[model samples]
Target: MTGWLPVAPCTPDGCARHTGAVRAPLPAALLLLSGCALVLLGVACIPLVRLLGAGPRRRLTRCWARAVPQAFGVRVIVRPHLPDGAPDGVELVVANHISWLDIPLVASVLPGRMVAKREIRCWPLLGPLAARGGTLFIDRDRLRALPAAVRDIATTLRSGSRVVVFPEGSTWCGRGGGVFRPAVFQAAIDAGATVRPVRITYRTDPHGSGLAAGAVAFVGADPLAASLWRVVRAAGLTAHVDVLAPIPADGEDGRRALARRARAAVLGPGDLLQARQTAVASDRANRPAESVHH
Candidate 1:
């Protein structure tokens, strides 16, 4: 369905193909239906908390979000590579946000609460579900709230619920990597938990033709529902989620260092194809190196 869309100019440096936006009919209908289902599901689950428990209800919500892409006829590709024996305590997943689909994209693979801006928590149906699901809403403007937010995040992690944060603050086209807002990384530092970085890309190639940067991109001032509708209405959709190894909480290099490393991994090595290969190789190298005694 994505193939039917036209490509536009991508201002991001490394994005080679003209970016395509999603504004199709099929996706529009599916998004609406899926959203309605989500709302209805939440309403139904509200009463079942006694029977299902918060954990079960949360799990169901995650499952519903995971199924959204399919409802819109889009396939989600997730490659999550975690370090061996990563601590079971709370975790912070730092992923790049490309489009509104990112909410579902990140939520689908990562099973945990989210650290989103205050706005998402009030976004009609989703807002209600997210708040009820235990998502930690951060009021970025209120510096006084930082300590409490950190404590809350740490508590959630200690309780075994993961938190996904898009440090960039907002979503962008997947054409290039964006800077990780330093303030958001504080939670991971304060909580003494590992930070896992992830990269996301959406392509039109149904057969996985490397990446079709030209066929899909949602950016700037474009209303979320309208942009998403464009993608759903298109002919085909394929997306990839590359999860890099998690960084230790106590790095000699600070969170900023980890952020730099993560940005490189997501952006690749400048050349698109080369960057992909390099990322794969680097990820392989970062694995706890083994020794062969002579």
Candidate 2:
């Protein structure tokens, strides 16, 4: 709920042209059903995870994550530029928040447990599915819960498992988002884990208008159902994820510094340039038409 809420401006006729282009009811229904089936399949496999251990559980969860986006007609493109000789031990994967799709987008390629807000735990079927997938929920509204959440994340990393955290704390339009919160970086420091910064941006097909046509962003106050509908109905949506070089959580860098560096990497040149281009295009599209004289 950090970025602009209203849809971008349309033409003089007052039609929400851009919005209308992305709303396909039939496709939405089909995509929703497909996503539900995938979730149900994951739910059914939950019992086996306990018996088989982390390896099987992670693999199953990864498959479910990868399929969810495909169900919604969203493709994930990974651009990894990891440093050579980086530690392959436990990792803390941090990325920018864009939409609920972000969960699966990140999970699909980089398999790991996620650190999500506590509200996700009460979202009906999704709640149980997330819990089963090894998600660690935190009550962001409560300051007292910070230590406990950090401890849980550290413990997970110390166990040689990767943990994903959205340091931005809230969702935003893919063009740009809020600053990264530094509290979670303590987990990486505590566990002596490497912090991997991943940048995720959304774009539409070349034949379409641009990223806005894809309508994958879940910003502002839009309800979950409505957002999901827009995503399912969108055409040629693609999520571009860039996994930057990993930063060491050594004594030289503290939690605050680590968070700053992570944010800088995630909001690198490519991301900033794209954001500016999107903003400029939006401005041009929203401009009023000049009246012609005889």
Candidate 3:
């Protein structure tokens, strides 16, 4: 659990365990059956949702979003704090990236269009589904494409729709994440929207104990299939989504300042403490191995 580990093949006896972890992987059959059922249900409802208008489509999308995580045995807990006089117009939601699960976890509470990497737009069934759910894809590798992506996001916001963006640009271990990229904040500035910072942290307990659990992060070089399998097998996994007070992106406020404030809100005092604890634990665990090597 100190670092990323390879997933063991499933067997009748059960998947192999991390040497010092307390939980055992759940059976593969259970995950497969639940996954299949969820997929079939989603496919059957696609046509129905498509027939509806935008408002109804978004509502149904929220229902399905909530259902998908439950199918994987993960619960989404939302803590929304909105100050009085908060703007009711288009809202731009910015959050930390922890795992692929962050999508459904956030969607379950706040339904909106997502800004995702262009690669996700071609990922088999998921790609098509995401497009139908109103995801805006951006080619993060191409610097030239930034203006267009920003324009699209601004347009979506101007149309009275919510848009979610992970400014970190990539997933990371749940303990902490990379710096927030300020480019996406330009969209909020351009649209004169309200930016709401959301903090997403995973836990192994229903009541989060302020610890960021590693079991829920999709980090390192793990394949999608392996991460999905691990998620399905994990028990008592919970996602904590904290929606901080909204910040207005007036014309006067620079995008850099907006990005800094948003990032600080997401990585608040509580998160910093949890990160420190995780670093200390990791250091202690590595000491024995270092001594043996020496």
Which residue pairs show collisions in model 2? none
Best by TM-score: 2
Better candidate by lDDT, 2 or 3: 2
- The predictions' CA RMSDs to the true structure, in order, are 10.4, 9.6, 9.1
| Model 3 C-alpha lDDT per residue in residues 77-142, reported as the tens digit of each score | 778733322333488888887677788767766677888877787765566677666688776555
For each of the candidates, give the backbone clash count: 16, 0, 0
lDDT of 1: 0.59
- Give the per-residue lDDT of model 2 (tens digit) for 1-294: 111111232221232113534536787798888987887877777787668755565566666777888887777677763232233359999998767888887777677788877778887667888888778877655556667878888999999889888876556565554455666788889999999888877777533346652266665455677667777787677777777889998847788788778877988866666544544544344232110000
Over 4 Å off, model 2: 1-23, 81-88, 206-209, 270-294
**Model 2 residue 292 distance off true place after TM-score fit, in angstroms:** 54
Model 2, residue 77: distance off in Å is: 1.7
TM-score of 2: 0.79
Report the C-alpha lDDT of model 1 over 251-288, residue by residue, as the tens digit: 56775776666566665676345434423432343232
- Whole-model lDDT, model 2: 0.68
Clashes of 2: 0
